[model samples]
Target chain A: MTRRSRIVGAGLLLLLVAVLSACGAQPVAQNWPGLTVGGGRVYVISGLPQQVYILDAETGVQQATFVPSGGEAGLPYWSPVTLGGDLAFVGFAESQSGTAGLYAFDPETGQERWNVPANDLILPAPTYADGTVYFGGSDGQVYAVDVESQRIKEGWPFQAEEAVWASPLVAGGQVYVASMDHNVYALDADTGQELWRTEVGGAMAAKPVMAATGEVLYVGAFDGRLYALRADSGEQVEGFDFKADNWIWSEVLLANDLIFVTSLDGRLYALNPSDGSVVSPYPYDSAEVADASDGLRASPVLAGETIIVTSGSGRVIAVKDAQRQWYWPSGLPQSSVYTTPVVSNGWVYVLLMDGQVQVLDSEDGGLQWSFSPPESQ
Target chain B: MGITDIWTVLILRPMLNALLGLYTVLGGQFWLAIIFFTVVVRLIMTPLMLPQQRSAKKMQELQPQLKELQKKYAKDREKLAQEQMKLYKEAGASPMGGCLPMLVQFPIWIGLYQSIIQALGHQPLQLLNLSQNIYPFMESISAQIPLNRFFLGMDLSLTPQQLGGLTYALPILVAFTSWLQTKMTTVGGSGGEGQAASMNQSMTLMMPLMMGFFSLSFSTGLSFYFIISNIIGIITQGFISGWEGLMFWKGMSLSSLLSGGGAKGAAAQKTSSTSSQAAAAGSGKGSQSGSKKRKKKRRRKR
Candidate 1:
């Protein structure tokens, strides 16, 4: 009732506002921008704005923007843009318009071709092979979409024990699915019948990559170990497991005879594909770089003989001959890198979580061009 | 370390670990883990919440005397302030007693929410963030990387709007339970007068609406936490302080009930009955008006 009491009341109200606003719901970056390079163009699936940017990979110029069926900006288009078979595919885990599915766009004009709706979130990037597209769904199933009819293949959508967050690896008539159920399954690609599955005892998020021999497959797990399984029977190979200090979420990159994998603990391991033995002077720790204390998350991209890597601390480093060649910023970066870097025409495209795209020369780690996409309308 | 680091170490990390531990123990049932975690947190915080409930009860007990003091010193502001403070002192109650404890618990509430979001790890980046917060020894949690999100036909990661249908009922239930908890802890006659009174009135309404809005906006898992936490809070408040203010439908408008007009006496009667019950529990000094009514009833029976 008193004037002082009124002042105190007003002050308390202001404090409540301050505290609530301070701990308020932040705009979360659930996933980094999905970036991939193909056909001389860099395709990016922006997270917050939910727009797909088709940029000229050489010049970093925006060639076309593909906004999916929903015009709203909040729909999730976090899956990597998959380019295959005359169409570019993007999967939205969930959309603000209450629709979720795999959407295909004409890469040339950035126009939508067809959308195959799914019952749940489409978390993994769709892999297009032969005439069909294979992708995993959050509903714990892998779907094969026929490109011609925009329909799921018959006897399809084989269910796994848990959600599949990793892109399916389609090779030699088999679909390899790594699921959160802690198992890697091999399914007959055409008939959607389970052939064999190997229990890794840890949830997997990284896509399975086949060895150059086409007889072995490599997949990483949250158990902090990378397992080598036979691509023919999905059985773990003896004495071929490599352990890391933390979770491996990045897809394993296979270049020539070496397998490059990054973990959340800032370690990058290069192993011989034949036996999972560490490459000499390998298991490079990215934290050794000054102010780059965060882990290495983005998968390494190989350009000619040079290997380009990005870290959660946002540093872009070029490594050659098992040595760090050049690192970017030389101090600290403004944003972290989570999306895998894309390499094309001697340029490495790194997309930071803050929507900044840095096109650095792959040979010297020099900044070639940089631009931040405009805010979503 | 800075404030953010301290918060992560002291609050976020511990909560994240405990919630994940509970998840592992609960066989990867994330919803059940959240519910159990909320109950454990409420139980742990009872010491802080007890003083707040008792303080509110004491303030409610002195409402009549406060009204009298206001009327007697209506013409003099300074005198009014002095008399109110003196009355509060005599009753061993402080008007600001609940504020400090409430402020202390605010961060815990926020931390609990943050932990839930981190543990859910619905998105890749969120999951990556979780990997950083997990304790080195939580290998079971590592093996169970992504927790199962769907429960009772609803995806725990999606908002009510995204879930749609029956999931929308969660926000309504959240608002109802929040209102019930607020009513149970609120001092009587907060709807009466004074700046403090008006603020309490506004808070009683705004807090539940805000909670409901948060329920609607946040993931269903968080909303589910809100409902369980509120229900526990209401029951805990009932045990700490007698169930005096929860007769919301009987009427919350103190001025109208005190105005002594027709049909309003029914609400007044219920209020006195509950107040007498509270007095019987040795919660407060009996009101003079209540004692007079008892005496009149005794005489009429004689």
Candidate 2:
């Protein structure tokens, strides 16, 4: 370990016994601190305390923390989002009551550029494509918000049966939302009208992963199944089951043709994209998987050949197989590290529930540094 | 605004959704999801907290001087006010350092409070002001368990109501944890800055009692965070200020120092410290450092 690492580690190691003294003895405070890095700045929004913060990507000193002046900083987006230009678009809902709006923020100041108003507080992650931002809402509508005007576009609000809980994916002018309605909707990016909406067994809670060639859309549902859909149309190409205990709330990680996903039963699964069958590192219980308190909200991020993911209690595992790999833990329990670990350059950044943003070394599950939002005055 | 809705948006929904997400990313078992959540929060807060910790230690170091000023000024009124302000300025301390850190924690505390209720099903009403939180299990569990478990008898809840021996281990733990916290933590005053701190005494007494009360009233899990958080805080404080305090205590015991008692101790100590440092620099031992080097250059001219 380096000098700084040793200081932090030694501080943590000293408290291990005391921290682990409780029954659940897990990490505390949960977060979905996914990375949206580029232009020397990294951005993340906290699920609690209802504020969004920006950091100096290199030093990690927080640049700002912004919350809507009028609304409560409540339930916003629950997944990692992709941003564009100076605008960072995330699923923007409020603490309670009213419509879930699409929140637009200035990455430099974390201030609101504008809010595209909607109906419920639950929000799906948003993706930028073809000059438009696409995300889902609890109002059971898939929304297309204009990036430039920061307003709900002229003709959109395609209705779905249930709330669109997962982040929306944009592939080839089509916005995809995996909804609790047990269906995945493929909508035209410009207009919110549905191109095609297909049901793939159970409630789909994760954003579908689109193929590089934009040929297939890989999505997972609570039924513990992974379905491959044709991009142009919403027809099922292939599907596989990761049947386990409760739900498969995470999205699929597609590395070329090898599809990786996890089930509520604590098993990491690998399936074939062509036929939804197991391939390379087929099926293995993660080196660290979810336990009773975790919902495994984080999606898997690929770091070269290894897949990195965090469990409910905040234990993050970086693995290539069922074989023992490297692991590090969030010292406190029930932290709810639902955010997917986002990798950039050689580092991985993630958010914690206790309002902490952590940076880790991808090669080993070692911590680089951790910072919290400025204690707002 | 409403507890139920706050619970929904800040705590329960986000926590569950994230938990659900982690389950999908890693494997089954909600515990891992919670773990992931915990690490993220700690790591994020670590940096901001370093400044807060330093402020806390500075507060502790100034306590003795402050207490003396509080006494000397207890009656003088005008001069007391002037001297105290000068002392604070000289110390370069914020009298209200504690509040800034605590204020910083308000949103987080609210978030945590909201998270537990929604995540556990105790209060879904506050979430997004929406009545529809698909998780039905919340209402059922919110009623029976009091949800509070004990880690060696500390009441995880810390509200004003709901404290007693009947609520399993939470109440006892609250008192014990608070005792340790109070004993270990240096001071509640504003690091000898800002305002007079009669309320701080009550704060020391009321916090644990309030925790005990809250434990009796609510779920054990929230109480659990409190217990762990307070315990962790004590540990961190111990590590950070232990040596300085030990040295201070030993230094105070030296010949003629202990004789000063309360007021005498304060004045004597502050003057001695300032004088001794100046003397050290004047004698050239401290000249190697930046500030002292400047003094050395000035002396060379003379």
Candidate 3:
């Protein structure tokens, strides 16, 4: 009788929740605020609307959205940057040449400061750490603009076999950049000299995350392999093939002793940080495909023990790190969420590529709030 | 460079011929052409698939004996393998029987999809041979279905074709069409349980839907292919499951005749089952007593 009551209660709760979700069912959302996570501020780059959305990081309430002041025409969605404090940087893309630059915005007020256009088109978000703002461009140069002067400082454009798409990573006075050349280059943070380079199969779209020890760098690749290289010398530390049946576009997330990653094959992988092994509890198999984006394209965010990952297929799954059990999915998206989810406190902030940034509670994966573009301008 | 090459001769030509036959018979209705094409494909595939189905039925009959043999040789894998071979021989069932139907069906599906794309000819050049003038209504229907709505609305060329294309409307279209296609083809068997299977089914439906939705920004031809192929597939599956061509006519007839009656019967059965468990069960008193004891224990525990 108790079992029956429990089942009934669960069924009722599920039915009620389903009904509510159905009422507020969003169209296939393309929320891809790519990998936005910082102190207390949650940021999402609304790629199509051509604006940056700032919301209460934990509560998912709309704080503000900043658009280019002088009637900005194009959307700057290719990349966005967080400066740890309240400052956020966004990059605009254009065909060949236009008003493509980087704007630093205040997360609280949605106000924009001076616009810093690179010598070339800003391809991705710049990295802001250690008194320097670092980003690369299609011009094949890694621009290190002084944070204070807001001008291009002594820059070192490492020439790759092809173009540069990934953002630079800073660790121990060095900036690590992965290139389409299938090489991970360790550069001098001060001078921008190529320190060392290691060839990885396929291009690396994901930025490398420095192991808490600042030795091994973990990043996923288009070759369907997760590579771990020595952050210092660019030597292969360890590696594992995702064999995703497709490419691995989702970046690797290191939380606790495990790494969370996804594939374009519609799978979320939890791997071992030490050896790049995905064991039983920490399955090599994907968690829940956020969407049918081919594989898991969204980056996974770690909120304490729970790892939240979204997919191009439009599913945001909460994976408990220790047990490796899926808590619940926020909901399937009508489309894919190309960007990663930002988890802070108890909330997971998702930047829907379809134009809405949704906030889901981390505990039960319940929808808390959603900030969509104001429809009529 | 043109997308079609000599490989077109092997797969596309045959399918196009089939499509041409259906289109000719149906008087150029896009929907009817799809139905005819699907029927022709399944009929052609049926001969190749017969051997496989028989083998599977044989396997099912052999499963019980195989399990018995497994139990008898629980301690010996070598002996178990030898005995299993004997059991298989006695049953006259090849172990690989199940994969045959799928093996025959998979290619037809792929070929059909490819043929649809080729027929729609999203590329202006490929459009050269497609017979768009076969029907007066065709030009408008062709415009309604997009070419790049690849699978669901997916631009086969783009990653998250909808998202990558930066076109949001496409995914929604994909989902709707995919749901329609799935409902048309889903197995009607009662045991539709298991969370994983449901998840898998949804994903399968979603992938095409995502592709279709993304196809909005792409060439309309791709979406047209998806719509036509799915409509065709559902028709084909229905024909295959429903005793060949007869089921479709019967289903159409029955839907008109039985929809209301069916609903009432289901509801009435539900109400009667609640009021009369004995009648619903229709078993002896011994089984009733056993069930009652269990129910009483459950009540007491509560």
Candidate 4:
């Protein structure tokens, strides 16, 4: 070929490459901020830039930040900053780079203590229990990592039939794992042996919550129903099935003798633990009140007799005795809320999908401080 | 509404729902649903592509005359262009005809890519966003909340780079099928000794490799879509035209194809022209001389 022809061919090749690249530009994964509060510090992973921000719990000011060293690009820290033992743990979701990792950091200084790559997406916060941190992996395994050794315990990563997006519930020598395979598994906490598995009507994404008595476990399903399973046998408790209109993705909060559950259909149900009966005139539908009609996603957090409900529509409501105490913003919000609000010392901290952290007075829902990460700004 | 809104309403929304519907029908087998979707899309697009394919075939037949015109007007570049246009006009062929089908396909590929990614819903945000796109009429969509993401021991929502090792086979198969389609539809290196041929030669080498690279970065489900779409393209072209060009082994080997040899294209064209001549003779049709006279008359009229 002549030089001119070669040049033209190369130019055309470049153009085609540009066009194809633009055509197949893949969408990157995004998530709401995963926030946890402990030791008077707020640990938040905003999922953008893959850094953990530690804030003063009282004032909501940035204290310290942790960024993984030599980190792979496009990996979102999806797991909430889990404070276990002396270290705070966070997990990076698997990316095209194939490196999903769990890292332990100094809760005070935000210094990395250790990191272990799981090679699969870690979606749920690691649950700390008795020197071992237990978390669910998208690879369908519940990993039990010893905090001291900073490694997965031998023969302890129990595999499920599907991805385990919910945190493993550990109570009384047993680990309860809810999987997308539509089954809740009870595994021996020490040896990782399966004790009993109960298949539910639909896939599960919410963490299983145990009753105050510790004998019954209540879990929500994508089938829009809450199933109460006997803790020891994985058998359904009779007369305790509460159905909703949409998927139940939030872990049911157990407080005030009421089992509080949020469904994607924007309704919040407070059921009696005995027979799954709705607290009369309860099951607050956000749509009936105002424009907060968008479905609820973030789990409700209890704050001194006030239940803080963060709606997917972005409004936050303080409910007490099945009546709304006060709702924030009173109008349109800049973005929706997906992260469950964390309450500490009478202050409610909500992480919006737009990366703003709104702090409010738990009693009257008054705006205290709104912090937007500098990186997001 | 905005352009993004228009795109979502007109293209993205329908494709997303159609894919979900297919996944439900295919028993939650995500990869199988992708293959079936590819076949259905190709079938729907075949009618729009038929005229372009026929025009491309005619242009391929006129390549020899176009090459002669290049030699006849070797120095007068302007005259060469005029003569080539005249010849194309006389033969009722368009050099730009093949481009229309490709132009039409670009948006579909883009929409399909977005649809596949959204359907896979690898993250919570993706799944939450999926609910918004689902039509209320698709009442079964909520029941199929999380479509199965696994196929053949691999996560369909993950890329080969994420899976690593043997999972790279998806991109390789994508390139292979793309090359097969190129071989079936392209005229090979026969229309030689020109800028267009040089570019065609370069394209025949680059297109498949580029597509393979794209699949490497895309989700494995999208890679499956590319492989299936290329395979469908090959079959569709073969049915629309004849299978002459696909007989790569007749006059060229693998090495020849890799090295940009003209033997494959020349051999394919030779087979095509010989068949036409034989049919003309069998029917007592006019010979090459008669055809030339008819072309001259047509050119004069034009």
DockQ agreement of candidate 4 with the native complex: 0.33
Chain B TM-score, candidates in order: 0.82, 0.56, 0.46, 0.85
Question: In candidate 3, how many Å is residue A4 off?
Answer: 68
DockQ of 2: 0.01
Encode model 2's per-residue lDDT on A202-234: one tens digit a residue: 766678888787888888765556778888888
Arranged by DockQ with the best first, the candidates are 1, 4, 3, 2
B1-302 in candidate 3: lDDT tens per residue? 13544435556666655664555556555445665565556566666555544553444334334444555687886887788676566557665443455445444544555555445443211232332122323332322222222344444423233245444444455555554444333222101123322332443344455445444444333344455545554554445433222232323344422422212223223323432453245422112333354356568999
Candidate 1 lDDT, B152-205, residue by residue in tens: 878887778767899989999998887778767763544235665555556666
Q: Which is better, 1 or 4, measured by DockQ? A: 1
lDDT of 3: 0.55
> For residues A91-196, could you state the per-residue lDDT of candidate 4 as single tens digits?
8754545667788889988898888778588888888899998988887988888888888888778989888888889999999999988899999888999999
C-alpha RMSD of candidate 2:
20.5
Pick the TM-score winner: 1
**Which whole-number lDDT from 0 to 100 does residue B161 have in model 1?**
71
User: CA lDDT of A301 in candidate 2?
Assistant: 78
Across B220-299, the per-residue lDDT of candidate 4 in tens digits comes to 88887788777777766788667766765676666667765333555545644753573365422223533565556778
Candidate 2 Cα misplacement greater than 4 A, ranges: A1-35, A72-82, A96-100, A238-245, A287-295, A330-334, A374-377, B1-302
The stretch of ten residues in a row with the least summed lDDT in candidate 1 chain A is A1-10
Among these predictions, the greatest DockQ belongs to 1
